[model samples]
Target: MKLEMIGDIHLGMALNRKKADFDFNVKKRYPVISVSNIEEEGYFNNKGFEYFPSTELLSKKYFTEEGEVLMRLTHPNTAVYISKKQEDLLVPSYFVKIKITDKNYLPEYVAWYLNSEETKRELQKVQSGTRVTSTSKKVLETLVIKELSIEKQKRIVDLVELHQKEKTLYEKLIKEKEKQLAAATAEIMAD
Candidate 1:
């Protein structure tokens, strides 16, 4: 039996700009997500656009063990969106961690599927409400998940991780090359 899981449902809340020293309040948290830090490109359905720097920030508080489990479950490159409703309730936006129950599906494989463009479009459609577009647990449960054998799922996960590691190595090499070039330019100028 396969089960689709969705969590982190919350109402959108407006940021209170009038509060003195808003930055001070956010700095108190260990991990925080502010509207300003969220790039416009990543925002879906104008919600991210509507809110600016003054918008309320979301933070996730976790015990050490719970935090480790969450970091392990989610992909390192995946982005997590916070909801305003969760803020009002004093709940962390990352409170809900989703996982599929399919024995064949590896966690990484499922994460990649959810992060794909096609899945995002489907998610947008299921999101309801006018003032603030929100998704419920039911909506996530109905998502169409790919069916694959456990062996295949693990293989895919391994391949994706390998590619990611390669990309990181290449990025480091490029940065080193850039630094060398800069040094050469500076030496030429000095002479």
Candidate 2:
């Protein structure tokens, strides 16, 4: 077990979008992930997106890639893992792309940890601005990340995926029950 500041583990140190010349009026073929895509748990499961034009470089910049972690600047600082399938999608300026260079850490696990309650509280303390309440690149780089062996990180990620699946199932069950109850209530009036 080890603890390291986020700055020491990455090749790219909190690559945030700033002063980009992208034209918002132009629509691109792909959708860029927005803050709305993040759920209460900070999982990027929702398909929220905004159409934005993709520019060459956008300042010689990189797009989202597999094994990369993205953190939303807004409150809760939602962090998401970039799977192979999610690669090629444009990450908007509001997101700070964190690519972990350390082989000891897995991006999925790192993202999961960032979204954890402990990290959330830590980030809340460093938040800036009165209205938007966003996090800065400096704070992100200074954040502490608890390190575990690669095997343990993998196991933890697997367990989280299973838990997410369970939550989905429970939500479906509740919706089905609600439908059945509504139908039954309608029958009472017909009797």
Candidate 3:
């Protein structure tokens, strides 16, 4: 199913675009997420987000929930699945949040697809800009996604995670081997 078919997808802070006007209060401030807080590998980076103070007359449904997907609009566009919520965290104007309204499609599944090579290539095609490439909100809605059974989607996520773990272990083993080889060579040279 196309991304649009699953839920309401739109820019996070369409109502407020000016960054200079923001007022952050130390006592009442809320954490805010930006493109840099989202990793290209499709995960959230909790380290770099800033906080914005609570303001009067904020609209409802402004904050993202667990399972909602966020996509960056700037160059090297990337999306992340909201696995957990950082309390009172708000997404700013530079990102679009996709709330999966339908139960048929899994939000995690869609996030995985968005980070895949196929989606990346498609995004690269539509992105325009020299200094900072970007994809428009309208263009974002048009991006396509395949519909897969929940079971299949879960399996895919599992496989990818397994591969990642194995890759880490292999890298560690290689490093250990390299250290051993270096030590052996040093000893032989000394002799």
> Which model scores highest in TM-score?
2
Worst 10 residues of 3 by lDDT: 18-27
- Ranked by lDDT from best down, the candidates are 3, 2, 1
TM-score of 2: 0.80
Which digits, one per residue and each the tens of the lDDT, describe model 1 over residues 68-89? 1111111111323333422322
Superpose all Cα atoms of candidate 2 onto the true structure and report the RMSD in Å to 1 decimal.
4.3
Give candidate 3 misplaced runs (Cα > 4 Å). Answer: 14-27, 46-48, 54-57, 163-191
Least well predicted 10-residue stretch by lDDT in candidate 2: 6-15
Q: Per-residue lDDT for 24-52 in model 2, tens only?
A: 53333445676677676646665757654
Minimum summed lDDT over a 10-residue window in model 1 is located at: 65-74
Clashing pairs in model 1, backbone N/Cα/C closer than 3 A:
11-85, 13-84
Task: Report the C-alpha displacement of residue 133, candidate 2, in angstroms.
Answer: 1.2
lDDT digits (tens) for residues 1-191 of candidate 3: 66777778877775343233545522345567866676667666547677665544355466777878888888667777776664345777778889889897777778788889988889989888888888888887888888888899898878766865786689799999999999999999999
TM-score of 3: 0.75
lDDT of 1 at 46: 28
